[model samples]
Target chain A: MSTLSERILGAPHGNYVDRKVDRAYVCDGTGMLTLETWKRMGAARLSDASRLHVFFDHIVPANNSTTATLQHELREFACNSSLTLSDIGGGICHQVMSEGIVLPGEVVVGADSHSCTSGAFGAFSTGVGATDMAAIWLTGETWFRVPDSIAIHLSGSLRGGAEAKDLALSYVNRLWMDGGTYCALEFIGEGVKTLQMDERLTLCNMAVETGAKTGMFYADDITVQYLAAKGQTVRPQVPETCTYIRNLELDLGDIVPVVAVPHRVDTIKPVQDLAGLPLDQVFVGTCTNGRYSDLVRFAKIVKGRKVAVRTIIVPASRQVLSEAVRTGILADLVDAGCTIGTPGCGPCLGAHMGVLGEGEVCLSTANRNFRNRMGVGGEIYLSSVATAAASSLTGEITEPEVA
Target chain B: MMQGIGHAVCLGQDIDTDLVIAGRYLRTKDHSQWVAHVFEDLDTSIAPRLKGAVIVAGKNFGCGSSREQAAIALREAGVVAVIAPTFARIFFRNAINIGLPAIECNITCTEGQKIRFNLADGWVEAEGKQYPIRPLSPRMQEILAAGGLVNYWKARS
Candidate 1:
């Protein structure tokens, strides 16, 4: 029995001695710099320009003079190479790629660690370094030593007020210690069939936190529908039989609103455990939980109420923002005293905008809570959109009550 | 055949890329500037001790973020090698590609303890105790011998 990863690799390499990826993509951060360095070093593209997808997100709109220069260089590279450039505010690389570029059964590699977010569509997506991406830019191929697959069979449905974020956090709590390091986490079973496309994206986006190569779900009817909604019509193949090195099962209904405390993504605790812990800020958007549905959930909890603490809500993409506006979710958020930021990765990396001060605490919907992730000397608590919105109202960590 | 002998500085698990070098410093591509801030957040005092020292860290030594700058900063700080129980895949590859030797070993070494590593033998000697390390693939070994992936690729082309 072959795993889904094996099936996809087999389709692309077809008995070749060395497994080669199907395509490669890069974001503005490392990819552009790597390409610029390559050009300076006298290397020219050796493959079709279409094989590369360039994104300018991480530091959109050029937060500083140095960043502006880097962005300018990226634009120049895109122009000179005749490659597709998803410019600033064009949405995060993973979001844009999932919505348009990445397809099921494809082996896609990107320079950003969260590239595994594309695995939501059943693609074998994983992160690589700039050098690897540069190599792929030249040859359109890079090798992969097939990774062992870990089977996580989730059953039951999530309890109200809990979300894919909680499920993902719980999985990290259980698996991050030693389970998924350098392994592919193939989520399966009844619960997998119930999660929406956005939720699946959230799950896969944080797979890197578990040290997993990629977190994937078998693309079924939901995936087809998601693609169909995007005007793509294709049936994605799923492997009939798969072998796993380890098997784990979880009940989604058992998951509660939880948060990953500061300094580590896996240091998780239920929201009830830390309720009333004061918060300095609350963020409602990022590649992990930034979607139209997430905004809607945030709006529902904060509507007709003023934010008691500093709060920022950023839609993952311009498309999500447009939808939020059309549905009046943006208005509700703005009315509730939350700052509405543009569609880009804002303070998730503490690069710019909404960075926290020393001795401050923030509950964010974004993935990853490593030390200094949001700002130096500030503690970051990772939670679901519902928890973040609820916490913003009380100025402290709170669990959303399901009525 | 390559070898290095240095004092070890030990750290805990999940010493992520951000801790190695913050994202704020990523604005500039200057390798030297990044080295100055290595472990700035983890411990302001660690960077000074990094030169010519071996870092002994717990599992997932370089985790979070795909910026090769983390590996570059460590190398620029004169870290001869990073010995960890495990490493995040991307960081490991970035280190090898950039000519930084990352050895995987589960042995414990005291801080400031003189340690020796033999790349050819794939072993680490600390406090007179020897621990076997997993050797890199032939391709990676060749790349390191050539001083990094850019040079390795340049040599081939």
Candidate 2:
């Protein structure tokens, strides 16, 4: 009667347990800080360089000399330490790791809040700050106060144009921000089997929005299949019993296309309610919805139709970009009046490539909608790739047409 | 006895890390830039008042992003401590890892009101009342005493 975290941490809930890391990573944003902290600890070499990774996603291409210089230093460090480096166009750290790099039952840590995204693979993954990541790199281990678990049971299947992003928003709306603070959201039930690997990743990506330590599914057939397709053979690691602090249920059929309004991710409303609300732009990409399937969905919805708004589409990784290009999805999107950006985090954090102008409104497929996140004085409304494509057609928030 | 005394600088619930220090300013490692822009989004005038201030806010403080720079900014800006009903787990850990005290206590405080806290005793005294706080574990206390995790580890090694 223990949660996945408890089992992985090898302790009961609330007990501080020190565990070895199977994998750890940091992006450009946190990499420098982590490196600095690692050096400040007077350590010269990584405890295990093979298990660590460095990804360049955020502010890729270097926004200015300051970032360029820092990224340069990080590249040198990665080279010196013999660490795996995913340079520009490598995609987001979460997405890159999910490409069979992360396995079930592993203790994975990242230096970004969305590191919880890996929990979709049934790994006991969580995010930490730069210093904590440094500690992990130095010692190849870290401490965790085993988080209590919350059981989120899903029933029925998503319908009526509802994508995994909407289900994610629905749960976040129900849990509210911080409702799952210091807790693990264990997503279980038959509905988990209905979602594809992309959808599961999307659902787990926003786990941190609810303040969860992680949102995970047990490694079942679906997890096995996903990894198998990625060229891995693994046994399912389903638990016999989980002692949860509380149980919540969501019917996927009830999930409608929803958007998290500006300044807050939990402030959700149906797409129909906000329909016809004008937007300055529409963005489709991030660690959350920037996978190949999401791009394919956006292309299918907008095929042969011109976008009324300035639409920006970014592939989450170089591999995703290759798939989109090979499938003609990229061409279809370009023909549909959407501009394609480099395969990385594009203006998700308001860095570059498509930063929203002051006072502008954007319906984005990214995870966050916080104030000034996309640009100073700009407002971000987060929605599904389907809704983003539909909204791009009208230059306003629009409900996706049911397929 | 780890203690701090400062005037309260109150904020509302769900103070996100972006609001504490926006993503745009994170490209540089300049601590002063972060200090200058700390909470600049929430209130442009608040940064000047952060020095020696105790931030009393609603539940779920530091609710978004895992940017340790947010905690670094607050600490560099001279914030003595942050008191809230609850905190996003990562931010709380970041604050502690950086030697900034993050206290969980629902103490009603008005702006500029003198607030004092005793981490060892696990209580916050504000406006003629005392609120008990959840004490940090002995390990965390030891880390804080050494100024931060790096220093703590440095001393140990």
Best by TM-score: 2
Q: Write model 1 residue lDDT over A307-334, tens digit each, in one string.
A: 9999998888889889989989899999
Q: Which consecutive 10 residues in model 2 chain A have the weakest lDDT in total?
A: A234-243
Q: What is the DockQ of each candidate?
A: 0.66, 0.85
What TM-scores do the predictions have? 0.96, 0.99
Model 1: how far residue A34 lies from native, Å: 1.5
Scored against the true structure, residue A35 in model 2 reaches a CA lDDT of 94
- For B102-140, candidate 2 gives per-residue lDDT tens digits of 998888879999998999888999988998998887878
**Interface RMSD value for candidate 2, one decimal?**
0.7
DockQ-based class of model 1: medium
Clashing pairs in 1: none
Give lDDT tens digits, candidate 2, residues A1-403. 7788887778899998889999999999999999999999985658899999999999889989999999999999999889999999889999999999999899999999999999998899999999999999889998888899999899999999999999999999989998899999999887888898889899889999999999998888888988999999988876758678989899998899999998789999999999999999999999999999999999999999999999999999999999998999999999999999887889999889989888899999999999999999899999999999999999999999999
Among these predicted structures, which one has the highest DockQ? 2
Task: Give model 2's clash tally.
Answer: 0
